[model samples]
Target chain A: DVKVTQSSRYLVKRTGEKVFLECVQDMDHENMFWYRQDPGLGLRLIYFSYDVKMKEKGDIPEGYSVSREKKERFSLILESASTNQTSMYLCASSSPPWTSGGNEQFFGPGTRLTVL
Target chain B: SQQGEEDPQALSIQEGENATMNCSYKTSINNLQWYRQNSGRGLVHLILIRSNEREKHSGRLRVTLDTSKKSSSLLITASRAADTASYFCATMTSGSARQLTFGSGTQLTVLP
Candidate 1:
């Protein structure tokens, strides 16, 4: 089965601290995405990468950034962690936007980030 | 309030009964996809229906797409307690093949 893996399942950071969440996929899919899930807000995209060394901002990318140094890995960075940023971070991957048959996304277990 | 909007933000149903969730999008889409997420976890894709398709089914899950109404629905028949989770509908907008905009999802509970 295809799998997406996140580096940390849980993290706690102090305010103004820089935090990084890493995601890796084993399927060689070219699309990677980072999202934050809140109780009522649902899943809000923070960033997404279509290919290595290329990234795009999503709906809520104000305080977030992403990096893709390799096809199998995508990283999400928080320049400065804040309490408001405390939420569950999810990483997902999909076919490079060109393939057919099950182009659906595959997700990681998720990282629960706590900003104090 | 996003492109894809799911109705009845929360639902509670008994096992063996069917559970249905509805989603509406604001723009034209190439496909509509549904996902399931357990509490405090990541999402797992359930199904995807292309714009040209009207209905599709997998196991106990049935999805229907209506391009004209810009809406779709997911029906889970003979639900089980294990089916309790949050259901999200994502819209793949026409011309945007890279990013799929997601909406607030519906929290489903199948009580045994």
Candidate 2:
């Protein structure tokens, strides 16, 4: 079984603060992703990393940045957290779609961030 | 947007009853996947049906895909209270990007 773990399950931060959310996967997957879930928007991809040091912006990546210094770890960074940034953040990892034969993403439990 | 849209945003049913949810997408897709999420948690992969396939089943879950209609349906038979969760349908398009587009989701509640 694949396991994806996040650094925090819940977090609270003041406005304009810099926040970091960490994720680690044990499956040695090459693809990792960060997403934010809001009430009506569902899950919107923030950023995805295909390899170490290689990152691509998803549909909504303006307010967030990501780091993939190692294969097992991916981190989401908020440059300046705002109240609007409060959301349930999810991290997922999977083998490269072409090689995996199936594009099934395994996700962590998620971190509910509250920016006050 | 290649995002799939789930119909009947919310569903409520009694235990031992059947529950069905439908999803419709806008573009051509290589595969469509279903996921289930409990409250305050990340989603878990449920089933994946490719465009070339018509129907697939896992345990009590049955998934059907119709490329012509650009839609898919998930049926859960003899649902239990533990089946209550938000279900989402995600699409992986035929392009090279390999990004999965997700729908808003359908909240299913099974009463005991």
Candidate 3:
């Protein structure tokens, strides 16, 4: 089975503090993504990387950034954690864009971040 | 902005009953996918239906797409307590970055 793992399942950070959430996939997929899920807003993409060292901003990229230093691992960074940023962070990976059957994203368990 | 919006934000149903959820999208799509998310967990891809396809089924789950209406529906037959979760419909637009535009989601609660 495809497995995606997160660095932390729960995290608490103080305002103005920098926070990092890590995600790793074992399937050797070439695409990774970060998203934040809120009660009513659903899943809002923060950033995504199609390949190593390449990243693109998503719908809600403000105050969030992502790094894809190596294949199989992607990290999400909160430059400065804020209360409004508190939400469930999800990481997903998929096959390269051009590949057939690549549209389905395999997701990690998720990281629940609390900003105080 | 979200490209899709799920109707009836929340639903409650008894086990063994069928639950249906609808999703409407704002743009042309290459395909539509459905996902299930348990509380505090990441989403799990359930099914994907391409724009050309009208209907598809997997196990007890059935999905239908109406490109003209820019809408789709998910039907879960003989629902179980384990099936209770949030269901989201994501749209994959042609020529886009391969990232899906997700809907707000429908929270389904299947009573045991």
Candidate 4:
């Protein structure tokens, strides 16, 4: 079984503060993703990393950045966190599609971030 | 932009009844996947149907895909109270990298 773990299940930060959400996967997958889920918006991808030091912006990448210095770890950074950034942040990992066509993703228990 | 949109945003059914949800997409896809998320939790991958395939089943779940209409449906047989969750449809567009565009989910409630 694949296991994806996040650094925190819930977090609170003040406005303009810097926040970091960490995710680690044990499956050695080459693809990792960060997404923020909101009511009526579903899960919108924020950023994704295909390989170490390789990152791509998803649909909603504003106000957020990501780091993948290591294959097992992916980090989401919130610069100057605002109240509008408060949402359930989810992390997912999957094998590259080239390796397996239409690969399924494994998601970590999300971190609910609250910005006040 | 959301490539897929789920129909009947909310559904309620009694236990032992079947629950069906539909999803329509705007573009050609390499594959479509269904995911389930409990309240305030991460998503769990339920099933995936390739574009070439019409239908697939896992356990009590059945998924059907129609490329001509660019749509898909998920059916849960003998629904139980534990089946209550938000179901999302995700699409991997043809010729795209590994990113998946997800639709606003359909919230399903099963009454005991």
**Which pairs in model 1 have colliding backbones?**
none
Off by over 4 Å in 1: none
Output the number of the DockQ-best candidate.
4
**Which tens-of-lDDT digit does each residue in A1-116 have in candidate 4?**
89999999999999999999999999999999999999999999999999999999999999999999999999999989999999999999999887763378889999999999
Error of 3 at B102 (Å): 0.7
TM-score of each: 0.97, 0.97, 0.98, 0.98
- Per-residue lDDT of candidate 4, residues B1-112 (tens digit): 9898998899999999999999999999999999999998899999999999999999999999999999999999999999999999999998776889899999999999
The 10-residue segment with the lowest total lDDT in model 1 chain A: A96-105
Give the best candidate by lDDT. 4
Q: Which residue runs does candidate 4 get wrong by more than 4 Å?
A: none
CA displacement after TM-score superposition, residue B68 of candidate 2 (Å)? 0.8
True contacts kept of each: 0.72, 0.67, 0.67, 0.84
DockQ values of all predictions: 0.72, 0.74, 0.77, 0.87
- Candidate 3 residue A102 Cα shift, in angstroms, is 0.6
lDDT scores in order: 0.91, 0.94, 0.94, 0.95
Where does the lowest 10-residue lDDT sum fall in candidate 4 chain B? B92-101
lDDT of 1 by residue, A1-116 (tens): 99899999999999999999999999989889999988878788889888899998888998888889999999999999899999999999989556874458898999999999
Expressed as tens digits, the lDDT of each residue in B1-112 for candidate 1 is 3889998899999999999999999899989999999887788899999999999999999999999999999999999999999999999888788777788999999999
**lDDT, candidate 2, at A49:** 92
